[model samples]
Target chain A: MATVVAVIASTHHPFYYRASTATGEDRPPFADEWVRKILTFRETLTRADPDVLVMVGSDHFHQLWLDNMPQFLIGKAPFYDANWYNEEREFGLPRMLLRGQEDLSGHLLREGLDAGFDLAFSNELRIDHSITCPIITLRPEADLPIVPIYTNIFAPPLPQPKRFVQLGRTIRELVESWPSDLRVAIVGTGHLSLELGGPRQFGPHGPDPEFDRRAVEWIANGDLDGCLAEVTLDSLHAPGNATHGFMDFMLMMGVAGAGARADHVDTLDLFHTMEAYFTWYPNGAPTA
Target chain B: MSRYLLNKFLYTVDRDAELVERYRDDPRGTVAWWEAERANAVLNCHTGEASTWLRFTDAEREALANHDHVALFSLGAHPFLTLTLFIAMFERDHAEPLGFQKQYAVRLAHFDLPYPDIAT
Candidate 1:
């Protein structure tokens, strides 16, 4: 059976990459501190030596649109290309040949389907910033294989938060059943509060640190039910429609298993958005 | 108002490169072909060729053309598509002509939105 080694959840806003080169006036004071914390998180992943990294993030109309939005989609390819944009280039993001684990991806698709989830499967999906920003910041070396799971967080009628939690449980079951002696790491990347293009798009609205604190506290204590109870569409959407990134966070919590507890937790509020980093071991211990 | 027309317009343009090229080639024709009444009005307002039959206020027309993101948002344009359209129309070449963050910062300022020192 595959051994679940580590689970990490962190924020992946594009600005995390852009802040370094920005002028002193444009750079936030917390930017350097955030980078240091991110590097530390990366070192933890490297120490875990996960063979396959399952990345859960949402698209931003870059790959999927309303015409063909799927509730959940998994990438099934041996190699995937990161969608290159001028903004990413300006940030000096290097061209990366993202590696994929086809065998594990196929198994996940089969398991997900049999378990009553109609997950969309794609072999040629291009990834957006949600996945890239995390990888670039946390794993720039690109040493391990990754499987991209695209959840429909941006589109309306999103799958219930509980469903994502259940999906994570299902993923855990599949990993446990795998015959290979593999180390797996799941990375959930997104933001805490972000409102884009709405009435508050140009206002003084920003990240709600109190909300983020409560949500993270629940996750750290293994209160999946509590996390879901508080972090609802109404609560997340209260900040901004773009705050749907919480869906990915819920998935990571679910994959950590119901009883799994956080051994380490770190967070930063970048004024407009909040970032949270967590490391979990299966038995609620510092080491699995 | 049902944002169906606006959603459809943005969805199609973002997903279909051919249609985006078509839109660039003939904005009015593309709008007419889409046959979405409100999308047509929105695009037409931007092109300075308002439909004779469509009735839109001068403020609405200016909002559409100037890529006033908040106005588009109020009209129920998807936030992702709103940013996509802004990039496609104004920042296509990635030239930070209006300054890197200013493009979005200025628009956010218009609506008294918080301007974060970050890129989209």
Candidate 2:
């Protein structure tokens, strides 16, 4: 059986690639500190030494569109092309290619369906920065194969928050039961009180810092009861219009298990939004 | 009003570099042409299989033609699509970093919560 080595969650700020790579006068004052934190966060995954990663992220109208939006889709292709032209035009994110773990993708799709997910599968998926940002931050080598799971956080009439958590828990169940000797890490990215294209956007910090403060505590302590109690489709709007992405974090919390405190936690209060990183070792901390 | 079509306009235009430039240089022309030629063209499929439905309302068309981000928000157009495409079009005009985005926010500051449901 595969070992569930790590469970990780983060914010996939598209700006980080440009910000961290900038130099000289072009570099933002906060860039160095941001890069330093990412290096340390990167070490958490390095320590886990997982052979495969199950990446969870949401598509931002890139490949998926309103014409036929899938609430939850899994990429089962042998390889995934990452980033899009606009991402390059807007954020300077380089094009990337990632190998996929087909067997696990197949296992998850089969088991996920039997578990009642109605999971959608894509044979050819061009992943966006939601999955790539973590690869840049945590696994720069991009050496390991991945199974990219996309949740519909951007589109409305989305699956409820609890369903995300249930999916996360189910992922944990299936991963542990998969017939493989490789160690696997589950990594997902989401937002924290972000307000894009709205009145509160591009603020000094994330639009609702108070909500971000509570959200950090909820995830750090694995407080799903507290998180789900307050976070509904309606209530999420108040934090910021785009805050629904936080459901991915709830799904990760479900992956981490209830009442399980994160072993590694860090955050940077950057403009536009907060960047958060977390890693949990399910069995125990890896020996460095 | 087909917020979906409004998004389709933004999505299609943003992805194409030529279209982004064309839309920025000629918003009215771009929107007019898009509605007629591309609005019902189901993506990732042969153009011959395009749908007969999916035109934007006059108000939706005008809001887009004018590049009115504020009106788009009111019409429940997806904020990310509006912001991304608008920034691609107008952000360069600003001399300062994030200047256009900050101003974009101010334009829509009058909007209150229960923000025109974006369900579609």
Cα lDDT, all candidates: 0.69, 0.93
**Residue range B1-120, candidate 2, lDDT tens digits:** 798888889899999999999999899998999999998887988767888978989899999999888999999999999999999999999999999999999988898887887878
Candidate 1: regions farther than 4 A off: A20-29, A86-94, A199-205, A283-288, B1-4, B11-68, B87-120
Write the residue-wise lDDT of candidate 2 on A143-168 in tens digits. Answer: 99999999999998999999999999
Per-candidate clashes, comma-separated: 6, 0
Q: Which window of ten consecutive residues has the lowest lDDT sum in model 1 chain A?
A: A198-207
Q: What is the CAPRI rating of model 2's predicted complex?
A: high
Best by TM-score: 2
Residue A108, model 2, lDDT: 98
DockQ score for model 1: 0.19
Residue A239 lDDT in candidate 2: 85
How much is the lDDT of residue A101 in candidate 1? 90
Q: In CAPRI terms, where does candidate 1 land?
A: incorrect
Best by lDDT: 2
